[model samples]
Target: MINLHGINCPEWVSIGGDQRRFDDSGKPVDPSTADRAERVLATFVRLSSKVSA
Candidate 1:
């Protein structure tokens, strides 16, 4: 049996800061601005496919 525990964990919706800004060390602070929705939607489609199939 596939364990579906914690499937809807709130951490799944967490978003990081925009990566347009750089930190003092010249590194991207957080690069999650783009593709957040696309990634989540992809995951939903994948999981749903598994369940339906």
Candidate 2:
């Protein structure tokens, strides 16, 4: 069995965030972005289909 024995992760929910900004290193960061839901749903569909079929 795949054991997730010692992972520390809080439950995630939809939330708002400030506008995306770049830091000193020019790395884009979103303090509170919620745009990942579509990506998550797509991945779930793909994985579920593979496992079920």
Candidate 3:
């Protein structure tokens, strides 16, 4: 499992066939599928901030 909290995943990949989201432990998280894109963008922003710092 990828340590998203540690490395900062920049993409919100589809976990289930219905565009669901899951955490490293295979649990249902982020109930809003529509927010996936924004979530991924947020991660990229955080990663960029860390990289630029």
* C-alpha TM-score for every candidate: 0.40, 0.40, 0.40
Per-model tally of clashing residue pairs: 0, 1, 0
- Residues forming the 10-long window of minimal summed lDDT in candidate 1: 5-14
**Taking the tens digit of each residue's C-alpha lDDT, what string does model 1 give over 1-53?**
23854355222445454646657886445556435645667788787777676
Per-residue CA lDDT of candidate 2, range 1-53, in tens?
23853432233335334444547785436533434544555666776676667
TM-score of 3: 0.40
* Model 3 CA RMSD to the hidden true structure, in angstroms: 9.8
Model 2 alpha-carbon drift over 4 Å, by segment? 1-34
* Model 3: per-residue Cα lDDT over 1-53, one tens digit each: 35654664648646567556567886556666546656877888888887777
* Candidate 2, pairs of clashing residues: 17-32
lDDT for 53 in candidate 3 is 78
lDDT of each: 0.56, 0.49, 0.66
